[model samples]
Target chain A: MTNKECQWGGEERGILIVLSGPSGVGKGTVCSALRSMSKDLVYSVSATTRLPREGEIDGVNYFFKTREQFLSMIDNEELLEWAEYVGNYYGTPKAFVEQTLASGKDIILEIEVQGALKVKEKFPEGVFIFLLPPSIDELQNRITNRGTESEETIRKRMTAAVEEISLSEHYDYIIVNDKVEAACNRIRSIMVAEHCKKERYLPKIKKWIEEVL
Target chain B: MTNKECQWGGEERGILIVLSGPSGVGKGTVCSALRSMSKDLVYSVSATTRLPREGEIDGVNYFFKTREQFLSMIDNEELLEWAEYVGNYYGTPKAFVEQTLASGKDIILEIEVQGALKVKEKFPEGVFIFLLPPSIDELQNRITNRGTESEETIRKRMTAAVEEISLSEHYDYIIVNDKVEAACNRIRSIMVAEHCKKERYLPKIKKWIEEVL
Candidate 1:
């Protein structure tokens, strides 16, 4: 956004927010609360080859795609980051994200750690945040209590959670989800604080100095 | 302090805050408001060779020092940063600040630009913040209208203000003091957000991951 239109007084285009963690870390809930609180946040919809659920709407949930369409996107290099999970392809569309940010709106991409790292490779300026449960016991409780998954799947997910937690150090911020509201508040504070970082706002201040001096 | 003693959730020792700005930028007003708002913050008491005004208390206002003691502190390297101003020595006492932070209390040192850069050289981990007035006009008004200072002194201060503002790019955070309360709130946000930085809390999270896995 132009410096005049910036809410955080930054002269940069917009921030790309990348949120990642293991299953049942409450990324969806935190993002929901964040989007509800911030009117300017745009959620990046992932194009997936998985079939839609009974009531899930296309685009509103995932951008439902055939395997052929998803493969085509990958071949055309249109996806920011993508991976195959449980025989389904899931990836973030790059064009929409670029447009949204170019229009001066922040966009959040909720993905797994692998995808997150991949996106970071392509977009190093993105704010990468890894969300975690308060403790291992809490994470286990959440995963086991999600009822829809089989016991075998839960066991595998627990193993994966440990690996994901280990990779959190690579992210810019690691937020422990004690409560959705508190987690959201901390994320919002990070957003505000990042905007105030010296590098981001130096140009605007320099402009002010130029005018004043 | 041990990481376990930290209240902000990071394992690192309490943050050393370095606040610097031009003379007429209302640093005192903002700091007063900040102290009242955050009872947890400890203001670093500087040792000054200048005689204290009648009502100012020792240790609370300043650690009133004789010129000889001040020179001794310089020789002993007992000051984090020190400078001579108006024929008097004013400097942050190293012993008190290190002691307070060892007890897990955040200490804020308010100094000028040169002292701040010097502190950064010695303690590179400090969270340096440069405060600015809302506008040049407001800064001029504040300096010129301070009835206690002569016009020549005001002119000198204005010149210093420009130079200091130009050096702000080196600071970690920059806050514009439009209103004391707002400035205080932003500073508070920076404190909270700094605790969330991945680098600060990685070891703690790593311990958690090791135990959980």
Candidate 2:
């Protein structure tokens, strides 16, 4: 009964949580709030062939690479999932995510629906979460209020939002981003609950039983 | 979007949560706290073959029944789970639990390990929780301090507690009975998180998608 054994000693399995959403759904804000609360989680950085924007660090923001290097990665199947946009290629490097998880840290990959599907294919154990606006009207208002894009761009994004919302069924969890704090708390609760799963705690329980009995 | 549909329908599929612990581990206190916070949850009243001692109601406290009736239930397999103690049979009835769950109300069943295993065999989806004392020495002290049992009974119960703790591995979650409020809060959090699982919420997501798309 006085045993001080650290019961769960198997290789630390990392939780891979994918956050997917339509534009202007406040997914970024909710994720930021979650990050502020939990320091053990890491956000995955995407590798891209496009040039880095102003004040963006190469490895921190995006792992900027040449077109030849990106294509070579695809040829070698080193990328877990990849997609092309405009004239550049963007993909998640398999090694980075695997290493982060192996070290017992949770990793969040913020990707679009297409890329999210590919990631799920590559890592079947990853948790997929979809963020939604409270309503279509609220979605429109949010996009319009951002004022960062031209009216034409906003309209195009709105159309894409509709399509993305239609695919929310593919996600494991649907969080309505009506309020950032509430959404973050719900996500955090999910994380805590996952940790208490019987399968994950079985080894510890087995050891406790063997020693006591 | 404002439609408030009971996504699971009136065809309720409520969860059955089983709480078990050694005596003096504060299980009753924790259950009372949980009930106070979650008024919607129904605590299942068990049936017993023992004669009523005092002002106990048939349905509210225990469904006091004749020994022949209890034996008849056993023959008919109407009891979800039961056990014999001191020449009296105590058990949970199947009809009441099923009817309550079908009405969309969560149910809590407080029973011992044997009864828990029986219920698990019948309903594998049920949530099984084990309450643990802080330590073996503390458990001995708590039981001894109760002053209701003889020294021989105390020793017997302590040995039983050890055996029960050894079987804690079978439980889905283990709540340490350090503080009643904290344990109840964790239980509530687990319940809320279970509701958010993909298997339960996927239908709502699909319906929303089909309607909007």
Candidate 3:
């Protein structure tokens, strides 16, 4: 079939990209780089009841809300996925994600391994990506260099990192964050490759075949 | 778990890679490039009953077998997949593929869509890749430019090309052969990424978690 004859119909499926990594592997940096490269991608702003930290903006970093509103969402099952953490509620709203996807924009969700599994359950088509540090020493160095946590916390976080790394098996793809550009390129390539899958292009292929034949 | 402590186990599932494209799309060229980059890859040699065209080596280009052997294989279901074209039989041996993968080598099976789909049915975990020319015009130009086929044969081949392209949607990945090096890089990256999938790494991950915790 001729490529020109193939007509793309309706809204393309919104790709659900789940990014998870060790705390210091720079997943946020890779995600930001990806966002800068493609404006069509929407970073899914998670909903939370945690008080906005200093300089954090409402609806920008998160949809910060009252405990009542958060509980109400949970009650109505409006959130695609949610989790209670450190006595505060954090969740992904269904409406915004659906709206963003319907408009043909890809959504990127940076969440932990556990949260990612929950999101995957709700959206089975979501693409799961696990980011890894080059080595344990590198991961330790990065965590220590951050200076946000004490020695005890660092050890605890490292233990948690190991647990998270174990869940790496559940992810669809794993990117060892040896270099930001290289990792971002892999992610971008995966996105491009996914779009070319048979399920996505069969209709167009069929139409093109009929025209050329 | 540390890389030193992590043991490669029997749980690693085999990856089935299917390579297909229009004639002269350089599928063989790309496959050769891929093999050069990874020495552990096992290239599946087809079992065929065709007389060896000049310079064709038995068990290299194909497993040259007699009609009786080929028919017996088909009857005994020893072939993973097979197809008859004109007066020759071509099939992939099931035992060789299973043995190659069990030894941890990535298997690359260069087959047509019919054979590919049949193998996929038996091994649903297979990765299917379709190679395409940069454009339809370029494809037609390449086919005609070869001067090997007459006008009538070219027309028949073009129709067949359209049919094959229509089935491209069944593939997991579609690579446009615009540039050889770039296509090779993407294909290699895909193989690396596939190896890092959670399904392949989960056992190691589970062990790592146990060690750390």
Candidate 1 stretches greater than 4 Å from native: A1-12, A50-59, A64-69, A148-155, A207-213, B1-12, B147-156, B211-213
- lDDT per residue, candidate 1, B56-146, as tens digits? 9999999999999999999999998898889999998989888987877788888888789999987888899888777778889988888
Docking quality level of the chain pair in candidate 1: acceptable
Relative to the true structure, how large is the alpha-carbon lDDT of every model? 0.82, 0.77, 0.77
lDDT of 3 by residue, A17-86 (tens): 8898767789889999989987878999999999999999987899998999999999998898999989
Predicted complex 2: CAPRI docking category: acceptable
- What's the fnat for candidate 3, on a 0 to 1 scale? 0.43
- Please give me the DockQ of candidate 3 compared with the native complex: 0.28
Q: Candidate 2 versus the native: TM-score? A: 0.78
Q: Against the true two-chain complex, what DockQ does each candidate achieve?
A: 0.44, 0.28, 0.28
Q: Residue B106 lDDT in model 1?
A: 84
lDDT per residue for candidate 2 within A1-213, as digits (tens), equals 011122333225768889888877887788888888878789898999999899999989999999999999999988989999998999999888999988887788888777888888889888888777766688889988887788899888877887877777677766666677876766766665555555564576567557766
* Per-model TM-score on C-alpha atoms: 0.88, 0.78, 0.72
Q: List the residue pairs that clash in candidate 1.
A: none
RMSD (CA, angstroms), candidate 2: 5.0
**TM-score of candidate 3 versus the correct structure, residues matched by position:** 0.72
lDDT tens per residue, model 3, B170-193 = 778777777777767666656655
